[model samples]
Target: MAARLLIGVLAVSGLGLALSLVAGTVLLRDYLYGRVAEQVSGLSQAPDVRPGAIAPSRLCEVTDAPAVLPSDFRLTVIEADGSVRCRVPGDQTGPPVPSVDELRDWADDDAAAVVRDDSGSWATSVDAFDQPGRDGGKGYVMVAISLRNADLTVQRVAVGGAAIGVVVLAVLALAGRMVIRIGLRPLTDVREAAREIRHGDLSARVPPGKPGTEVADLSTALNSMLEEIQRGFEKRRESEQRIRQFATDASHELRTPLTSIKGYAQLYAQMAARNTGSDAGTSIAREARKDVEQRRAEVVSRIDSEADRMSGIVEDLLLLARLDQQPELVKERVDLVEIAHDVLTAARAGHPERRLDLKVEGPVEVEGDPGRLQQVVANLVTNAIVHTPSAIVVAAATTDGVAVLEVRDDGPGMPAEVQHRIFDRFYRADVGRSRRSGGSGLGLSIVRALVEAHGGSLECVSSVARGSTFTVTLPRAS
Candidate 1:
């Protein structure tokens, strides 16, 4: 993230710098060209050419061999005779023809200039001077200078700016790493603390020092997590204790029943082995049959009840395990209303007498795992069915960019205290009643986990004996 941040910042800066350099170069070119054009116009628009009639041979002495004389050009320059003075033919390198043409509209007596093409590339600036003749006649005088060398000045500025930008970027990157290293020092300490904690040092804590900005927030978050872990360990210990106690108590309870059943069975067997009267045999057989039947029924009931409880526990554990191991969901749009109706149809079977106030409304689609999300909805609806007293009203709709499916049951509303603990595993408001009613106590917990896995939120409102309402909100795909 840090490296990318730096690159993003530099990319923006580089672009701005490049654009500024380009604009500055263009402006400078215009300025330089304007200055040279003004000089040429000034000399050409004058009343007459003056003293110096520098020949190409002499001009080459002062200027480079690449220089051109100003009196020769393709364009017609109006001389003092009102006739066009086409290039009077000087074997000299000259200034830019474009610049000379721009200056051709000068006064009649002005030093009318022309462009000369001595070098293959004509690149220069020109100036003209008028020399007075013997009888007040006009003689044209022209001066030339090359532009190829002068324009190099503009390019240098652009190159210099680009070089400076590169230097600035290098300096920032070098200094930025040092700054980030210093900035993240506190995090390094926190990381080390976490590593040590992972290795069984539960008592380890980040030093309560003011490390720096947001270090406090990081510490607070980590501390909260550790505190939660500590509390979870305590809960597990308590749960294990309960399990052991239940195992011991259940074994003791089973032993008494087993002894009674075994004693009766043995007594019947002994009588059958000794007593040989036909009437006696029949009497013993009847008595033994009754005892065996009663014992068998009691054993079956115990096993069935306990097995149900154990199975529910296993299912809850499995659901939680799946939730923790969030697998990739096959995301696709599915109409949830159809699934809701199907679930409702199943739930109705459980409560035939109760007036099921169900409201199913939809056609709203969502991007989610269809099966898991359907399970979530089913659990929530079932929870309400078991808890609500009056009527179960389910409604599905698409609203406010979210596909909201709500199940409200007019049952006994749960108190705030019970509502707080309802989503916990093995938690039940009326434990005795819930168990008797075949409640596994994991329904709500499973519901919550499934909702979260879909990146959705589930909320419940309960009024004891009045009703409990559960609202599920999922993002709409269409």
Candidate 2:
């Protein structure tokens, strides 16, 4: 592209230079010819010299005869019969005089004509005069100047101008190429970045260009677009991973309950079959039947419990799906402090031995679905209670047009790595404990989703052995 542009620049410049040279040469040639013609015309008007004044057959040496005549001027006297009567500056010769027809043609128009011969080119003019002492006799005086110097001057100017134009064009081409390369450096960077991206380097970026230029703006815009694309790809990858994990977790969760239910059902069936074949009146058989009935009842209760647990997990999964799809909520102004008090009250009643405290700074009112908001608070409180066996504090306050709810516990805090995935669905800090305690690991995930759905944010700050604090911030009601 740069080469083509430079070529185009040179082409246009060369054309202009060529036209200028032609025009200048033509104008200079015309001016030079006009000066020569003026000199010839002036000389032709000089005083007429009679033929008797000069000796016949001897050149009339009029070198100093007239101050108006230049040294290179050639003067000639022509007779009516096309003969040279005299010559001026006698040593100047070989440019023979004009013929009678040419002299008559010049005499008729009172104009000058260019005459060329072996000596050189000349500007010649002629005028007719009446010859003294000759009846009905006419003669012509011809005046001329050489054009060698003028022609040489025009030639030198044309050649010099052409050479200068070529040098200037070459310089322009070199400079233009360098400038174009510098100007297009940003685009080269962008191309390299794109190549890297195509090779799977998502972090590549174009170098910035000169500020306020089109190239700079383009570079900035391209960098922004690349960033968005990279982010989109990363998000897609994370989502896929999460989806796979969710499926695996769901299958494992359902499998455990199903396995237990199936085992108990099979045991109950074996017990019933054995009891059906026994003697009803025998004491040993009656005792055996009574023990089997009790065992069967226990087995049936266990199966029902497992089924309920499985059903709860399924319900939680469906709720998450709905929330992920942006479920509609009944949003209204509600006091977060009131919600916090209720959640803490329930937590205290459930775990009466645990120390639970409620701190309300003000009536923290926010716009949100009351039921979902209550669930969000309950989940956070429950998560804290399950993980930490220390004093738990549930706080509510309002500041800066936002309502803040916090659940804090004085127990072993989570590590940074754990905190990062703490809110991921089915991610348990203690998997065995979580499962044994009937935790599906969806508490924090649901809490986060519910908070976000109400235009709120959830954040956790934790360090190993430093205790953890979960804070939820929602926009205050207007």
Among all candidates shown, the one with the greatest lDDT: 2
| lDDT measured at residue 377 in model 2 versus the true structure, 0 to 100 | 89
State how far residue 152 of model 1 sits from its true place (Å).
80
Alpha-carbon local distance difference test for all models: 0.63, 0.84
Error of 1 at 58 (Å): 97
| Shift of residue 280 alpha carbon in model 2, Å | 6.7
In Å, residue 339's CA in model 2 sits off its true spot by 4.5
Please provide, for model 1 over 1-478, each residue's C-alpha lDDT reduced to its tens digit, 9 standing for 90 to 100.
5577567767887788788889998999777766655555564333332234443223323332223324332112234443334332334333443433354443333333334455422222233334245355442333444444446888788789889988977887777767776767667778888898889887677755475647877887788888888788889988898668545544443454455556655655554454343343577767766665566566566655655555556666777887879866779887778778888788789778766554655487889888887888788777666655566777889989998888887666879998887776656666453334536566787888888888889887776667777888988885
Model 2's alpha-carbon lDDT is 0.84
Local error of candidate 1 at residue 100 (angstroms): 96
Give stretches of model 1 more than 4 Å off: 1-298, 301-305, 431-434, 463-466
Expressed as tens digits, the lDDT of each residue in 1-478 for candidate 2 is: 7788788888998999999999999999989999889878866775443345442222244446455356787777778887887677655673567667877888886667888888778888888877666786878877788888889999999999999998989898889889888877887798899999999999999987789988889989999999999999999999999999888877887888999999999999999999999999999999999999999999999999999999988888888889989977897889988888888888888899999989888799988888999999898888888778889998888888888888998799988889999999988776663465538788888989988888889999998887999999999899
Task: Please give the range of 10 consecutive residues that has the lowest summed lDDT in model 1.
Answer: 57-66
